[model samples]
Target chain A: MQRPVPRRSGGGLARGIPAVLSVVSAFVIWEIYVRVSGISPLMLPAPSRVLDQMVQNRVLLWDNTVPTLKATFAGFALSLTVAFGLSIILDFMPRVRRALFPIFVVSQTLPLVAIAPLVVLWFGFDLTPKVLLVALVTFFPMLVALVDGYASTDPEIEDLMRSMGATRDQIFRAARFPSAMPYFFAGLRISITYAVVAAIFAEYVGARAGLGIVILNAKNSFRPDIVLAAVVISSLLTLILFSATALLQRTVLRWRDVEGHR
Target chain B: MTALSLKDVSVTFGDIPVLDRINLHVEQGEFVSILGPSGAGKSTIFRLLTGALPLQTGTISCASPENSFAFMPQRDALMPWRRIIDNLTLGLEVQGIPRKDARAHVAPLLRDFGLADFTTHYPAQLSGGMRQRAALLRTIVQGRSIQLLDEPFGALDALTRTQMQTWFEDRWRAARWTSLLVTHDVREAVALSDRIYVLSRRPARVIAEITVPIPRPRLGRPPSAQAHDIEAHLLEILLHQTGEKP
Candidate 1:
């Protein structure tokens, strides 16, 4: 952990301080606005009240958080599997890609409110509906990223490989797959965020547990503080998942980041 | 002995004739170049050889067909994710050599290519000339005698191009591999090739074959008058084909 850091990533302290300050100052301003305006906690909770609600219901929050995280991870993994399978098939068969890409795009345009409850109705409201909804929302980005990545390789490199007696599979392994990695990571970064939000939305459609249920319950009961607390937890989860994706990309694609400048 | 020979090769792209009954041959331990204007189907001939494009009509025979040619493309085409060593050894790996063994085979040559210290560095870490050197090294380390280069250093700046050309000319003198270079650069063809084949523009046909009688280490001395005369003649033939200046 104490290893000498390259200037690019090592300047994180300089880069992060302003963002941290901006967020902190936003919360401070919110706290002051609530105090000065004397807002009713039911209508709009103070930051302090939300913090207290979070602490008081910590056990309940933790229990609900487990289910949300479970749904997110399960759904995200399914998305990755299906997307990878489709992208590879599309890579090999352009006809298949041409036939299916339009359908994939049209799937993204489907209204989630119209679709999520139907998925719940069909899959019966357990972990299955949640995972299906997440996969439906998240798989497209990863799939497109992978397809584009595979196609992005220079044709000259393919010829070079062939002249050296490389088979199609060999060309893919040596050139296409490695070339596609950066795009794949970019897709993962996008899809992971969608997975987290989609998980919460899955619960809102009809799940028995999760932060979405907590928020919905609190909203009905006029406990804005509880609603805001749940919102904060979900946001934090999204941030963590996004950061983890970034870290994974930096580690696996180390060659791109060598010498810091590139 | 003849290393590779092409007989009556002709290509037409959907009835637009690209190459027309071209006949050429390369001898073992010789540096040969095909000089043509940009779209004279010089690349079409290469594409046919590499099997990127189907052979419309041709008989290409190699003395040792089992040995694959080390082909260097104009783009350098270095895999960015791979370190210079891994990139240089990629051809060996393609030929079914294990990665560790390939690395061992290329380790001794990296230094001579000016990439010894940079072997473990990624391609993005190297300069344009260095990356081209690494690409050339990758081509040679396959242990193949025939090298097909399509303007391998054409992307570099003038100074770097000259340096690489000089370095490559010296290497060709030492090793004497059977090579076929495809280029539109007249001076480059005259500088490095033992013999140059000039091709006419579209519907390309072999117009002339000129042998360089200049002495070795061609770049070692101020290019002799004979080398310049050959270059001017080749340029005149190429210009006549392009209808640019004759």
Candidate 2:
């Protein structure tokens, strides 16, 4: 006997109520805290002032955001290619996995804050450093997730594939790779959040234009509202990227999600 | 000539022996079962036969090539992402059959397998018996002369297992492929197998080779006294292997 799969009743908008409520409550609390604490605009701009500044300087903010977005996407794309390549190679060659996995772990331990400056020193004030920083920060998690995914393949399924006269590549394409999709998306969700932040951090160390530069400029000019506006914009970009990853994961892995009800 | 034969097959893991000089055979179109309690190296034999594990010291000869047998493991092992039709046609696809041809080949068989309507459904959407039915169909559509079934009904509940045992019997009788089943259940062995090879625990060896001479369609009527005698004798041998009184 089997348990019937529970049908999903509400669509996205219906299920989005709790999330909307939580966000509204959080914003309300922040607005109240700023007004009651009587913080000066220079020290901690009220939510209303930050919102006003964001609207007034939307053009300037958007102009700087273009560079940060480009760097993040560039680095994220590079990281995806590298991680996919390495994970496949390492999965096929256990010796390589053994030799390189430790080195990758050590690479992650190198703090991005420390490494970003050095990367900028070498790559200069162009987009390369920011892109490299984003790639460096996001690579290991996706690689680890993929490697573990490949390793965790059901041996029985692999054996079944082999018994059917499937070659190594056939087994990989049919069983190993498909099984790893969920883990890949999960890794992407985690790494996507880091991509934008890493880009901003690299820009903070050195950049001609970006959200990092915008924040740095606002800070130098002692406009806390503008700084907070940049901060809000950067965070919004992260949220947007994260939500996009989640939505993509849901679409691709719609089959797996049904296992929850089962 | 026998459809498949294993002579002096021995396997060891590190210092521990798993199967020792095991020999068995299946005649063409025969329903054979290797019966033993759990940890009897039943799965080890399967792995060796399927070429997943190295055959340490024995010779395994089959009428067809190594890949000529379709295997159904203990778990359904259905790809959750694929629909029932896709899962059924996986073996054909892996053997270089194009998806279109594979689908066309498997589509007609789905109705006989009682999975015609469920072709578009995912594995998660099927019942335990239905999933196993689909798995069995998947193996058969591989166009293999021999089928290796490793406890195909082991995961089902007792009631479903009984129902499936009969259902599988009917299917086997109709298809009549050279089939080898590995299971620990004695009644199942008596009910389904034309011949049963009772095995000892670890480092498995053939303890008894009992032929079930009962007539076909053994499920509809009460099992004959001859079937009971065979079941009892097989159980006694199995219990003896485990150092127990039957």
DockQ of every candidate: 0.52, 0.67
Using all chains and alpha carbons, the TM-scores for the candidates as numbered come to: 0.96, 0.96
TM-score of chain B of 2: 0.97
| Model 2 C-alpha lDDT per residue in residues B98-206, reported as the tens digit of each score | 9999999998888878998788788998999999999999999999888999999999999989999888888888989899999999988889889999898887889
Q: What does candidate 2's lDDT look like per residue over A1-262, in tens digits?
A: 4456667777979899999999889888988988998877798787889999999999999999999999999999999999999999998899989999899999999988788889999999998898889999999999988998887789889999888888999988888898898889889989999999899999999999999999888999999899989999899999999999888887888787667631
Model 1 spans > 4 angstroms off: A1-6, A259-262, B244-246
Please give the TM-score that candidate 2 achieves against the real structure.
Answer: 0.96
- RMSD (CA, angstroms), candidate 2: 1.9
Check candidate 1 and list the clashing pairs. none
Worst 10 residues of 2 chain A by lDDT: A253-262
Per-residue lDDT over A1-262 for candidate 1, one digit per residue giving the tens place of the 0 to 100 score: 1113244754778889999999999999999998999989888888899999999999999999998999999988998999998888899899999999999999999999999989989998688999888889999999999999999988878888998889988998899988899899989988888887899988988989999899889888989999899999999999999999899998889987764634
lDDT of 2: 0.89
Candidate 2 residue A187 Cα shift, in angstroms, is 0.7
For model 2, fnat equals: 0.68
